[model samples]
Target: MYARKPVIVLLGLAVCGGLGCAQPPACREGQVATPVSAQRHPVAGHHLRAHAHNDYEHERPLFDALDHRFYSVEADIFLNGGKLAVSHRNLPWDSKRSLEELYLEPLQARVDATGSVHGDGVPFTLWIDLKEGGREIVDTLHAVLEKYPMLTRVDGDEVLPGPVTVVLTGDDKAKRDLVTRHSQRRAVRDSNDYSPEDPPADSAWGYYALRWGDYLDASSTGQLDASQRARLACIIENAHAQGRKVRFFDAPDHPDAWRVALEFGVDFLGTDDLRSLDTFLDGAP
Candidate 1:
């Protein structure tokens, strides 16, 4: 519930070419700045929609989110010297946090250790936000991802079930390149806001992500107006109709905000508060 971890990324806009957009994310009021308790909460069960935004920033990166049984976790990566290095910024890139070391290898280990689809028996999403890229980098990653057949994959008209799914965000060029090079890959592109009325793109994209602050004009009441709710519902419906999951990233991190998202049938909950969100969803039947 710590307000400092603001929804910095409003996923509504499709990012492409490069990491050029630095527009500050839109914010909604009515969120009280409450400090997240240091006391850790025990895992209750799996939260399929829970996504750990900027998970690498946590003390345990993927492990922390995994402990809570979060279905998805995000990591920011920079392709440096033919190696994908995981870091939030360039100046302090740590070689020890390379994507292979931190995410890929660990994920493969988990998959190998398990007899189920995912190591833990549920689908896990590893969101890789590339800070920079080139064709070779995508090629390298494609090769690396090949070892894990347990990851969901797209083969022509069919999609095979896998334990883990890889999603590429942030840099748009690399995303397009990845899909173009490997049409039948375990990874998919995470793209911007789209409406049902809009003509659908190719099947390369897997999710329609948006920043809620851009669409809804909510008041301090902590509820969306009927018209607002209807608008959101239509977007969700349209995305689902297109076989795409819908995620809104920049919504306020509050119980009311979460309740509204759940009611609107949001497919993913963008959160940094893994424990709090899991606690909230854990109570759901």
Candidate 2:
């Protein structure tokens, strides 16, 4: 179901998508320049918009995504024996990976080593999708997150941005409780809906995560048409205006879908093919 060969990029890996393909600019040779104060960041040219969906499913989990320079990563967790076990299903006994072990610990280590996830102090997002246990699981997560000082914190109306920001998705009531109930929390909630009529973002709601199929149906040929493109643009525009970043879950995990997302200025593009998306975004303007 996935395209093995990379799309979007044509000759010289120049991506035009549906738009007219334009030749890449001529390269100016031998214009190398160096700054007086030299410093190397691990992900110097990282794509700030790349999101690793179901990151834990990968062989290396969080590390794999970081190696590819992904700015955002998602892990699905379920409550098991009062511990947050990372998995997509409710098999607690079968899963031994804890959220702390899989994501939080490694992230904290990276922050400690580089003063940030990528040595750039840019806020990285750790999106936790609650699979079950509702309030119990969320509370457990909050406790675990609090132990890590690298996570972003909120005191009243002030947001202290740290190296990592935890955004909780799924379990609507639990997420709302985390936002409304706690005055000080290490994590925030992700807005599942993106309605133009909805109120602006607050401390609780920092991102808009919509399902791909909820908005538009692909044409008979299973591709987005002009109308879909326009609607997507409007959705992203509305999200941006509301001071909330936008990302679509379960979106088409390929270059064609990625092109439309980039064209519409989607804040984060979720993909299982990390390397392909990284390469595609790298080649994009």
Candidate 3:
């Protein structure tokens, strides 16, 4: 499915999907000459806008997404036997692959060892998709996160500068309780779609996640029509004006949709194809 385009100059590989394409095209000569090239960061030329959706499903889990330099990575978790287990759907629980083991522990260990999670010491988002056990999961998460205070902080409304910012999602009531009930917690709550129920954009805590197709028809229709592009612009503009970062989830995972996202100034580019997004950003201006 990926035997078309050749790898572009300065970009190491032209990726097709998560599995990557056959090495038909040769890698371009020389490394991408971004300003960070002089620095020692591993993901030197990576763009911070990329977001890894269902990151735990990958072969190397967090490391795979980190290798791509995605600014945000998400995992679905369930509270089982008082432990947070990382899994997409409710199935036979695996204690060995708990949230702590897959995400928190690795994150903390990496920061302790290198003083950075992404090799650049830059702060990034760790999105936790809470599946079940509502309050239990939220509480469990808070406790686990507290130990790594330096990496994940909590000071009332402010999270402070930290290596990672943990965002809680799922079960609107549970997420709200974490905020309204605690009054002071280290974690942040994911906002609902912009509506009367949701906090004002200025008051929105973490991010505004919406359906990409709702704004732009480009996903199914190939490229966005002029009107569709305008709709996207309006939505993005509205969110930003309210001081909220914008993300379009469930968008088409195609390159065409990705281009429109950049054009609309999207804050997060959600995709399962890390390699393709990584390749796209590497070659993009």
- Which candidate number maximizes TM-score? 2
Candidate 3: list runs displaced more than 4 Å: 1-46, 195-204, 219-222
Rank by TM-score, highest first.
2, 3, 1
* lDDT over C-alpha atoms for residue 161 of model 2: 92
RMSD of each: 8.9, 11.1, 12.0
Instruction: For candidate 2, report its TM-score.
Output: 0.81
The model with the greater TM-score, 1 or 3, is 3
Whose lDDT is higher: candidate 1's or candidate 2's? 2
Report the C-alpha lDDT of model 1 over 52-162, residue by residue, as the tens digit.
888998899888888877878888887676677788886555677888788777787787888442454667788888777788778877887787777788775567767
Quote each prediction's TM-score.
Answer: 0.78, 0.81, 0.78
* lDDT over C-alpha atoms for residue 200 of model 2: 81
lDDT of 2 by residue, 1-285 (tens): 212221253553334346453322212232222112112224543378889999999999988898888989999988888888888986745434888888899899989999999888777999998876466776787788889999999877778999999998987888888777778999888877666566787877888788765554443222566545545656666666678888887776778777766666777878998899889877775
Deviation in angstroms for 111 in model 3? Answer: 1.4
RMSD of 1: 8.9
Query: What is the per-residue lDDT of model 3 for residues 1-285, given as tens digits with 9 covering 90 to 100?
Result: 112232222343334344444222211133121111111225544367788999999999899998887878999987878878888887677876788888888888878887778667777888888776466776787777777764555566555668887777766777777666665566776664553223353222757766553333443523665544545655565556556777777777878777777766777788999999999888765
lDDT of 3 at 231: 50
> At residue 215, what lDDT does model 3 achieve?
32
Error of 3 at 106 (Å): 0.9
Poorest 10 consecutive residues by lDDT, candidate 1: 31-40
- Higher-lDDT candidate of 1 and 3: 1
